[model samples]
Target: MKWLLLSTLAVLLALAIAEGEVWEEDDHEVLIRSERGAKNQECRYAKGAWTECDSKTNQRSRMLTLKKGNATNCEPTKTMQKKCKKACRYEKGAWAECNPQGQMTRTDKIKAGSDSSCEQKREITKKCKTKMAKPTKGKKAARRNRN
Candidate 1:
């Protein structure tokens, strides 16, 4: 009957409108950090934009929320992208994920042995400095005014 078809169409239209309204309210939260061992910063999503907050020194955090159907692929900004790709921590022998802007996700941390490499490099540089300084002084003294 014509009335039956009309009723069904109306129901479908109402359902579609309801679904759309719900989706507008849907929001997701994700936390981004600059490095591992840093505090787990918190980011909140409710409206449409991503907001980044720095609550701790030397740590960066961000929050993102997009439309229900939009992709959640958080991309880092240009400077952030390079900085994020920089090695953070190697976990289980694999690098952790970072935001598109290079800000670290909840998972990235300083790779093991990273600290040791810094220490070793410092020691080597110190030794090289001592050796280089000794030879440079002899040449400088020769050029100085003689008594």
Candidate 2:
């Protein structure tokens, strides 16, 4: 008798599956429901190309769209973000006194929290005007003697 009952249940389950009906089992009960409008299937998304990095935010973003035939409960579109590979930042020092070549120079060092790819130090140089001192009286006498 038990064998006959089990075989009947198995046949019913097979028929339910073939008819687009799902069987859900709980601790104390078995439920049968139709697959139409059900949110049982996993969501699927089509990913879009990543956007250019934003310099101010140091981040990049991409769009995710739900693929065709996905469940209605799934979100249609979403956005995702990631940190961008950023260049290093530098802090410039004050310009030094002008040299004999009428040029001034300054140093730049990587600032705190700068990207690791940046160089540690940089040097900059530019032309400058040099100050002149007045000639002494002894220098004038020497010129007179030479003449």
Candidate 3:
């Protein structure tokens, strides 16, 4: 029983070491435009880490590998995060549209602009009307009616 347990432990350890590991012996090839390797084959990008050559995948990137079925993926770095933050195509500026009823809405942030002129100098003349929700019940209602 002890021997069987030992054998099982050893096998698990070996499998853990072998999984998702890009070894020096793997003949990783640099392809044009991140092409994925075939099943059990190793392909890689010109730069970066991670190799899923033994698995199933077709997605490829520079210095990355694809497995037998799924596409290749790489761990995102700071650069990727920055790219995502600035991905929006709109330019950094403010735009305002005022309706005929004097309802004005200011432009929100598209990107962080330093010297945006979204502010207006003239004061608006529109006044909004407010209605009371609940009128006074007894004495206040009598007073309001007299007023």
Candidate 4:
């Protein structure tokens, strides 16, 4: 009886240690905060790229691939995805799309020939270019070192 009790306690201790109080994985932590839905539906956490898994007819599901931005490398389960769509809303403009690849430019850059509105196009192009410019050398170096 004494040996059995001791053995049981030892096993329990080992299990607790194995489970670990703090375990860190280099895996990306993806957080999808849906402004308008259920908690689980509004946010998803996965271990790889986002995969759209939908069975509902006429309903379009998005397979978002997030990198080091707001979203990470995790796919939300089908249920979670459904919840997220209902929750998320376009904060600005008609709609804003964010994916793992990056932001998509809807309007074409100011066309060169056939002159329609060069001034407006040029202004938009300049602003867009500046906004999308890469980080400075120092900031880039820091990012590289983080990995």
Worst 10 residues of 3 by lDDT: 77-86
Separately for all candidates shown, the number of backbone clashes (residues 3 or more apart, or on different chains) is: 12, 0, 11, 3
lDDT of 1 by residue, 94-121 (tens): 3334445544323323456553323221
How high is each candidate's TM-score? 0.15, 0.34, 0.18, 0.15
Off by over 4 Å in 2: 1-86, 129-147
lDDT score at residue 47, model 2, on the 0-100 scale? 68
The predicted structure with the larger lDDT, 2 or 3, is 2
Clashes of 1: 12
**Highest lDDT scorer:** 2
Alpha-carbon lDDT, every model? 0.34, 0.70, 0.38, 0.38
Sort order, TM-score high to low: 2, 3, 1, 4
Tell me how far candidate 4 lies from the true structure as C-alpha RMSD in angstroms.
23.9
Kindly list the per-residue Cα lDDT of model 2 for residues 104-127, writing each as its tens digit. 999999999887667899899999
* Candidate scoring better on lDDT of 2 and 4: 2
- The residue-by-residue lDDT of candidate 3 on 1-147, one tens digit each, is 999868965765455346643322234433221222333443333335543322234332333333222234432221100011112222333334556674554333434452233332323333334445875488877989899
Supply candidate 3's per-residue lDDT for 43. Answer: 34
Give the lowest summed-lDDT range of ten residues in model 1: 120-129
What local lDDT does model 1 show for residue 117? 27
